[model samples]
Target chain A: MKPENQTISPNQLFYLVSVFLLGSSVIFLPGAQAGSSAWLAVGLGALEGLIFLAIYNALVRQHPGKNLIEMNELVFGSFLGKVVSWLYLLFFLFVSAMLLRTFASFFAIIMTSTPLMVFLITPLVVSSFAVRSGLEVLARYSQIVLMTLVLLFCLESILLAQDMDPSNLLPFMDIPISEMLLAIQNVAAIPFGEAIVFLIFINLVSAPLEAGRFMRRSFLFSGILLVLYAVRTIAVLGTHSTISTYPAFAAVRIINIGEVFTRLEILLAVVFLSLGFVKGSVFYYGAVLGFSQLLKMRSHTPLILPIGALLLNISTLLFDEYIYDIIDANMLFPLYSMVFAFFLPLLTLIVAKIQKRRIQKGE
Target chain B: MLNVFLVIIAYILVGLFEAPGLIRNKYWRELSIVAVLLSSSLTLSLLLAMGVRLPMIIPVIYRAFVPLLTWLGIM
Candidate 1:
């Protein structure tokens, strides 16, 4: 089946976006550099993220029925467009590889005995299958995953309520405004602004025009979840949340309600992994679909496993230690991500608008 | 050795599963692309299994950004 023929509902789009947004960031806690003010950073970051989302949505609206790859071709002409598209394809693949690495590292920490490749291959294989099945299947799967994660997260949060120290969140925003701004930038760059990938899927929605609305709703939902997640980490782990690599998991690890709910970090792991799967699948599918479309291939199925293997290899090479991933997230990723997430999309939208005016004048 | 063998077998299985469908459809271009990607990935995976260290661009990129971030006082 041609991927273009597959369509998912707006609700499915919402679920997929929410799941993808929460993916690794939920466990990794994107704005931990802000210390006790991590939640505030995320809150401000969501506002900035909305601006990025609006740019992506405007670009999609400008080029309805066309993915970011196709829009590049139409806006920039064949040669330059192909170059831009290739860069974007690489960006998508790189993001997928990063997500895959994050997933593997998370599991590697908890399941210390399991080989890292096993964790990496598991999600890669599953995502390859989902990508080959087409976008509808992936979206439907995300719908189920997002619902389960929400229910479990709520249950876990209520169970950990007694463990939350309100004072941990006190003296908030005490950090230098510059550090706070950097943390906000970090949150905006990751999890939120990374929704630029959704531009690829916007064309896949049955209601393409309404895709932006659904995306906004998903952002609101995930933004709230992200703030709650940051607050939870700060409340539960307090100062340790700033230093803990996996703050969400560490917070949940302290859940010892009469020792009955001890080791609930396992539960958080399950939720994070599920979100990771959806996140990985979206990026994987976007990269493959974009590649096939860029090549003018009739189908993306044949490309799935081959690209998956490359992705697995790339993921392995991404970070030797988990600490590098954290450093990259804190220091480099925000700036590095901006080129693709903000600059390129903004450039595309402006050129598309200019071209549209020229065409209208010619008519 | 076993890890390398398993990596090879995994690549072979993936090839067998995907190549036949492309050949059946006579999707020559698609088949070629798949062959190129699969072979390259196989080589990379084999090297990885053999404990070879491949050069990574991420660190370089991270390094390149360090001065900019530090100058801005974000680092």
Candidate 2:
């Protein structure tokens, strides 16, 4: 709550952005994009993300030391501004739910047969506690988790090198151009575009000018890491990557250094849990912060539990009976997110600029 | 069947008790209720229209209130 007490260096901010974006997506993106051409999607997606980040940077520059909610009120009229701010809060909450559900479903499939809700509730409770501690703790926690994830990822990728077939990358770009573009849009909207949530905490950075540099570094680092993982998944699973529901998990399952290095998906699960925890905590924090701003509350700590409970309920309720609904979320939620996260914010920025210009001319 | 409903009830009760402390101002109390109700209704309608079955007990309550609320011209 004390901005002076919260001092996150530019390096830490970079690490937070990298880890938050890289998270669990690297494990599954190859399977989602599939085949030899997934890297093409990654390349295009990174470019789209950079453009989106530019728009965000412009917004940040225009409203130094203000989060999106405050800027919304400054830009739009009170009623419309509150609506937009609330929509963003809802978006953050929905994302938190989706990530929680995904992590839970993954555990249910690979790690345990216990009820998904039981596995999920533990993370939700933990994340609520983490968010209540405030942003500095979350940022520091992300740094530690990101380091562990990177170490484990490098070790796993190396161990799996034997199973990898370079031939799997052959015949690249075979997919239609349109499909590749669609994949780019998907990637942009997801892992890259969703990092727009960082805008909520941009004011917390020790150096605002370095935000662009830190964000770019985070995107490139995460982008490269994801591309490497995708390459590994393709090489290990070959054309079978498309068939496997969780190609990264399957790839990890296939790793065997003369049978001693088998079944390291457990290690991958640790990475997933760490990344998922950071992601959930960040969104949960954002939701609480946005709610506080909307109500003009001094702090969000007391509200954390109720919001966490609401999210827990919404997580369970949001999904349909079939897993296909979850997949449909992959298809639908990204577009919905773009409206609030990118398009709406951009509109607000334009309106703010116009209003400022009008006031200056009147003077 | 009964257990899940009970768990949900417990969750809602926890939320209701905490809500007052979250935003203590009178204006915020009214705003918070409106925000919760409108958002919940919007989500419920959207999910139902998508053909997702609401868990049985929740649907019964929603069905009862939704019509009554709609008839009163309140979302």
Candidate 3:
């Protein structure tokens, strides 16, 4: 069992949430489904993300100091709470698998020499090691690595300036309303919906109210970066945004700084690997903790390696080909994720409200 | 095959890494979870080593969900 003494301050929580939000989404760029309207979709996605964070923040405020699991237990009582908690764990497990697969599959497209397992297994093992060290280690690791990531992104964007033409973002907001709405649905589930895992970490905030503050800031910071990235990618890739498998990589690959420095895309490997590491480690830790909590175990470390291995296997075998999962994600995942993102939290909030009223009536 | 051998060695190393604490602490549930994990990993690894085509999760999930998904207007 991790001691309660392992509390991280709101400041650290802010960096952690920012890095977590920036994690896998940057590499994948889910808003490209909106075409030239991708930049607009990303902006709207940020607005939606703020709403999502507001719900999470409100939930945290209503039941200060209690994490998502404890909140479930309080709202639903022990037996049902554990069931809901188990479902959260299952969601964590599958989502971790989904992300691992996404990253690995992206690399598989780039390099064919390595067998698929080689890519899938490395991050899972590395993340298990990180999870075993506890949250303080993750927080410190993110603080340092996130600085490097930001610096690298700034450098890459500067180098790519010649290739990016703003005119490529023309015909903006021209997509059909239904298509834009669909893109929004898809965008919401990604990056932000994946953040449903944050519920596990928010309870560890020293002052529970500060958790909300840190998270809202993280949302905005990550939101701005994502929106800029989508616009930049669309500006460079133009009509290719709809077809480019890894648009960010494609956009970055063409950077030529006075003909002396080309293929700067190599540095992007850092972005992909590091951000994926942070994202994977977060979800992996969440799954391990949630699983142990579901089992009523006080310590999660003992289960880390096994769960990590299971995650590797599941993620490696997640799809026959990458595109099927991509399509499913765009199609069904929005609906699937809403069960967690909207319904579950909303249910908990409503039920908690009713219980509080009953208690006040008694008092 | 060399790959199968390496896979076995990896499982053994994982066992070596985990066994002592589990025994010292009498962590039966963890020991079981490790056992299941190692066995599954080895099974998949050995199959890959032998060049057997592995069945994927999507077909089953797609088959089962097509009706429900279609019904929900999400297919």
Candidate 4:
């Protein structure tokens, strides 16, 4: 594997991964979990996220500078290694497509009446441009976007503070443990667990020793932010949080400070759009890198557009007219994400560790 | 249905523009393009067949938000 000439500071890498992990998905979390216990579910989900970070850190520590693909070859024999690598690559593409669809769906619902295709293609085009420039450019862009998102989040929270009611969070833990576990599972799989893609760029960090520390801090920070926002939504909207399809949007819509400082949903949209872009670009970058490594291409740039086109098509088709049913009932996304993001990576780490022990004994 | 088809056509156009640079020297790019198109088409077809309407609450909330917007001077 060739060494990457460009290096990103630990903080930039931290923001990139943090923003990618925390996107518009956080907005729906309260709705999905519902109940006053939603905060507990998010807390449980954060624990699950820590477990994932542990697995990711273990893998990176073992094979410095090598991605999951290269590590696959090192741990498994060439034949099986290539097969596993291909599966991982497929997972990356599917996730990128999923994120793209989610972004477009949110935009269509809240931001604009423009056709879904327009919303979808805009980010794909922008992502393709970022990929063409390379990973360092994407890192720099993430730094700027993440900072803006944080600022907007703070401003929105401050402005909406008066509308928040403490009574909404009353009777906490009223839900059965079983239902709370289910909600936690949903959050874990969708947002935190799906962060497996960070494995692809762990080696790009300028300070490898700080990788674990940065990941932990960022995950905690984002998790806290998500929890506070979820609390705010529940406090403002009460049980309406579950009834509203997009609780965050509705929460923002309810912000009427003296009637003079309302309709700031557009600000929320901008924040969501920025987070979506970072998420899409990270996934896009990971998929392109996976393909480039798989085919042994000199650079990943050439493949960016072709991949972007395919993602656009997939995004549009993912939730046809029956999208409501998909969101309301289907458990496929959570199940599939857990398999690819959590189980598969954990399995790979186990295999690698076993192989390492064997080699050590032989030596 | 027609709207969905139009969206699909737009995607194809985007793909066509991307093909030249993608095909310069890699089989994975070509393979990915095919996979994306096929999977997306299949998913879209399934979704259209399901024909789920947007829920009523979305618009109700949108209506609710309108006054809030006017108050905020964003409208």
Candidate 5:
């Protein structure tokens, strides 16, 4: 069902979802909330993600080859569907900008000598190249990146093992229920809610039904990786993980493998940057593709730059600085994202279901 | 300021880089969108370069959505 010459295999789709889900959340999530119970929150969050993905899957399964944009029109009238589609596109662009802002700020903080714009522009530029090359290329490229990420993630955990004290994970589940729920919601919203964007890719797969199987598989794998990483952060950094801005990174910095592996934090940075790039590219492509379809344009190529520039500008103005950005993405993004991920889609599903029953009764 | 100079140069280079193919294909809508978006980005970039502080959108959104969040009991 992918555009002419653009079909991706279920295997490719599996890895694509894996890398996309792991993107930024894999880095900042351990430090988000729930204290020493943060890893528990991650586990619960993965379950929550499956629930959200279930909703997404149902929406896509209802209609065989149509993407979300098309489904809205099919469910609602053209006028209302177009509005819903437009909202999703705006959400995509906004998320792209936010992710870009996150990575750019990290670069600025780490390499203080370099100008911030360099950090902002470099990834956008690289991601634009991926977006412009088309979906098949992007899928192949992401598969390679995910392999490197998995390898590096394992190596980093192994190197940081000695520093971890099992006592760190003790005295857990002490956080209040509300705080735990908030942590779960943050994980649900930040990584899994963003999976809503993949609805835009429904038609890009060879078999949309096969998407559900691979999506579930990908979600399980991503969930395990996230949980493992969160535990590693807790074990290594202890309760200190709750307070620091970047506990995983800080823990990685203390990776002193017999005085030889001290500089391995750079590998962690590379992991974050590469994953962020994959995440941003998916969002960028979603926005461009959706916009072109809305406008009835034959090609989405022209949009790759203007929208990139628009997003880059928006990234700079997203928040005053990094910590504020983090606070907003963690605290505020969930409530904002739920509309697109949950409420709006649920509305579409209910309305579509009723309409189907009516037609069946008429028959 | 060097920041201002570098930004304006960036605007020009992007134009030089993307404009020709758009023109060759005679993509008027694409060309216009690129023009508008580039101009918007360039204008904002220039303002920031000149030591002007840009107000962020997050606080406004946070304000607007506070009521709903309170209702949901998540805030």
Candidate 6:
């Protein structure tokens, strides 16, 4: 990864971040508790995501050219920094594997006869190639993939418009306030807070100082798109959106435009696969790049496939019924995600600020 | 059993595909890391292919959080 030579444009950053934020969330629909009001939770989650992005950007501004691992070293000293970086490496790997498994399960729905390892290996192989080509390639790919997703999403929604009952969005406060808050927290932690990984790539942007603005814009873009998806799903599927494993796919299946546009669920699958690829490659790139940096290696290229193999192993064996239960347990998932996403980065920022103040006083 | 052979062969092909470049560059450290990662993942994958029940790490993470989430009444 040539960070200095290969700088990501603001638009590339926007597309990458937008696709990543909208990844598995499109299929799984985080914040199921919000029901028809899930769109509101996504809206609020984007607002909260801006605050999270602000903290990440502040960290970047504090250490202009340094990535998360390097910033940890500067702020916490080498030993503690290595420990924190290792934890983040694990987090990234876990996230990569989780995203891989999410899509594999979705694949299983379509290809029931196919073996699990096939689903796991194929994506990892593609993502390994993507990660090996480096971040710029991944960002370039996101632009095309995100555009396709948006177009397919719009076409499907328009086709389903006839079947949509706008009244389905009524009685918005169906869930209790506390549960609604939890649902909002789930939305924030997932697809939104997951943007914390972008901190690692912030310094790779053409103008690191302005990357935050791009990220904020992408968050708003992805948020509005997700809100539209939520509303469309609710409008098409009604209360059944909460129960369907894939509300978007089910709703797309309902798209019967004079039999010409019926059975449009394949469009949803294509959208999910493309979004998952972009998201997976980003996380995959983050893990390998960050680890290589931690190891003081010149290139992360060799590590890509090996780490990909590890991801394959994790995705294949780690995702079962019990793991699904844990992941679907909205309470645990959000709180657990916040530890790596919000808490650690905030702590690093505060400690860095305090250390800088002390140095100024000493000077 | 054949599926396991295919997997092993696939890994071998990947190793063959990548090793020459590393050897040419004399990136011995990278080669070693790649060797470690590939071998470990291969061992785990082969075990999985054979239906060997490997211990999972996620359950430990879940155990750590389950108690806390349960206490919050959000489980």
Count the clashes in each prediction: 0, 0, 0, 3, 0, 0
Flag the better candidate by DockQ, 1 or 5. Answer: 1
- Compare candidates 1 and 2 on TM-score and give the better one: 1
Q: List the residue pairs that clash in candidate 1.
A: none
TM-score of chain B of 3: 0.70
- How does each model score on TM-score? 0.96, 0.84, 0.92, 0.82, 0.94, 0.95
- Please write out the lDDT profile of model 2 over residues A235-311, one tens digit for every residue: 88887876677778788988788778788888877787888788888888888777776877555655676677677
Best by DockQ: 1
A236-329 in candidate 3: lDDT tens per residue? 8889877877788888888887788888776777777887788888889888877776676546776787777678767766677766786667
Q: What lDDT tens digits, residue by residue, belong to model 1 across residues A1-363?
A: 344578899988888888888888878777888999999999999989999989988987787888787788899999999999889889889889998888888778778999898888888888887887877787888888888888888988998899999999988688998899899999999889788888777777888889999999988999998999889889998899988888888888888888677887887788888788888888888888888888888888888888999999889888775667877888888988999989999999898899889999999
For model 1, state the Cα shift of residue A34 in Å. Answer: 0.9
Instruction: Kindly list the interface RMSD, in angstroms, of each predicted candidate in the order they appear.
Output: 1.2, 10.9, 2.4, 10.5, 1.9, 2.1
Error of 1 at A148 (Å): 1.9
Of all native A–B interface contacts, model 5 reproduces a fraction of 0.64
What would the TM-score be for candidate 1 when compared with the true structure? Answer: 0.96
Where's the lowest-lDDT run of ten residues in candidate 5 chain A? A1-10
Instruction: Output the TM-score of candidate 6.
Output: 0.95
> Poorest 10 consecutive residues of model 2 chain A by lDDT?
A321-330
Candidate 6, DockQ to 2 decimals?
Answer: 0.60
DockQ of each: 0.75, 0.09, 0.48, 0.07, 0.59, 0.60
| Residue runs of model 4 more than 4 Å from their true location after superposition | A1-5, A111-113, A322-330, B1-75
Order of models, best DockQ first: 1, 6, 5, 3, 2, 4
For residues B9-54, write the lDDT of model 3, one tens digit per residue. Answer: 8778878887787778777876776687678867876786677788
Pairs of colliding residues, candidate 3:
none
- Rank by TM-score, highest first: 1, 6, 5, 3, 2, 4
Docking level for model 3: acceptable
C-alpha lDDT of all candidate models, in order: 0.86, 0.73, 0.80, 0.72, 0.84, 0.84
lDDT of 4 by residue, A107-186 (tens): 77765768876777788888888877767887787788778877877888898888888898877888766567667877
For candidate 6, what is the lDDT?
Answer: 0.84
Please identify which of the two predictions, 4 or 6, would achieve the higher lDDT against the true structure.
6
